[model samples]
Target: MTGATRTTEHSAADDDVSRRLLESSATLSYDPMTEIDWEAPLPEDGYGLNPEWSTLYGTPLWDEMTEAQRVTLTRHEVCSIMSTGIWFEMILQQMILRDQYVHNPANAEFQFALTEIADECRHSIMFARTCAKLDVPAYFPRKDVVEAARIFKSVAGGEVAYGGTLVAEEVLDVMQRDWMRGENVLDIVRTSSKIHVVEESRHMKFARQEIREHMEGISPLRRRASAALIALGASVIVRSLVNYGVYRAAGLDTRRAVEAAANNPHRRSMMRTACAGLMEFLDEAGLLTRPAVAIYRRVHMI
Candidate 1:
């Protein structure tokens, strides 16, 4: 097809995706402030997440941990993940806001992009409150990683920006699916995960559509390079999800806990399984190149 024809088709597809997503959000988006009981009494026996989802769940270290220690560790871990989610949501909000600058405001694409930014703002606030309610201080990514992402979020655009957004959403989506359903999990976590899962489903779809639009006419060389860049972003996100401070906060030896979590086969399996659908989507979008796959393998995301 002609270049003009392809551009027209892309616009049509983008419009259709954005319109449907807007409709979905209007029908079912959440306001966590009113939804969660901020003052509810905490169940002393509830866990922050499913035990199976814990990084050190199957390790010998986990076996040695007292039940109380296990509970503390998981609380710190989930709060750490929420903190990371806040960081990433803020980053993507900036990227999307930047990308939409001076665009045709009448288009559904522009409107949905703004809507996503609004949603992410709310999501970040929700995460922050959850951490506060749990009495867990926010765990930030390493200083250098934060500095690096500062540069990336400011400069990233097009497929690379949308691709990174999709990777983060997809990674979190699979785990939150489990968290939302874990019967023994904390009510706070379960309800928040439910809200996140429902809303982020639309964000993931919007991102996939955005990435497809960006990829439509780019050259193969640029496509491969974009794949590698997005993979690198994914590596940063995976590494930052669980901060080392969490172990210290949980009263475990930071080094030992980190080592155990790093080597846990069960955790690796969980990551790989969580990423399978994401990997398929990336592969179909031609963003899962050899170099990208290699990067994902290093993080056990493949």
Candidate 2:
């Protein structure tokens, strides 16, 4: 077969796959009230979550926190981490609406997009309400809004190009879900977790399949894009994990918290544990090309 014919054949194959995905899934809804469970009681002990998470913060930072600070972080930062998942989800929903459904009003993807938008709104509200219950300010600056938009824009390539992002978001979700499951979370938080767990599970599955399919045809330049994105993802993941309050209260330099957290072998290992499985999956899917692995090593290691 000629090169041109091969390229044509590949395009047709990809188009077929995309169509199959859209056709196979049932239509989704935008209704949040009907979808989530709002009455479950919070867990009694969130410490026995994934042992890595317990070990990561259970030592120096957990011990250093004041009762008030502990209450505040538990109420706010703990949930904030989960809420960050919603935050990024909502951003992607908007970006999808902006780019994907702009012309197609009844696009099937729009339904999933709307569901995420509602999910995120409720998650943030519940998080703030829980913070108020503990008298912790649930304020995230508007600048973070800008930052989120910037990152989303930069990463808004096709499903394959943005695969690392999907992996990162879901892993963070696991961390929070496990944490909440271990502790005696507030009623609101417990309820929020029910919604998050269900929705994120579906989202993660969708993203996983989509990413795997998208990675089928990779090129060297796009592979480099994947590499850069994975590196940025590591930075984003670490920064997201490094709580500013944790550093300030621990009497460690807040300025170097990310460096310190990344430098900590245990913490780094924990992060790698969270991400490495997905890394291997991507590698098998041909998503983690040579360039991407090199970039991953550089950012993940000192």
Best by TM-score: 1
Model 1 lDDT tens row, 221-267: 98999999999999999999999987887788999999999999999
- For candidate 2, the per-residue lDDT at 194 reads 56
TM, every model: 0.96, 0.67
Off by over 4 Å in 1: 1-10
Separate clash counts for every candidate: 0, 5
- Give candidate 2 misplaced runs (Cα > 4 Å): 1-72, 102-110, 139-155, 216-218, 246-262, 294-302
- lDDT of model 1 at residue 206? 91
**Predicted model with the maximum lDDT:** 1
Q: Please, what are the lDDT tens digits per residue for candidate 2 over residues 1-302? A: 11111221223443444444444334432333444344444443432133345323545655665554444344445544544554555555555444343433354443544554555566556555554444443333246644865766544655432464466565666565665465454545554565566555555655565455445566767656765665565555545533455445434456554354445567556666666666766666565766666766655622
Model 2 — TM-score against the truth?
0.67
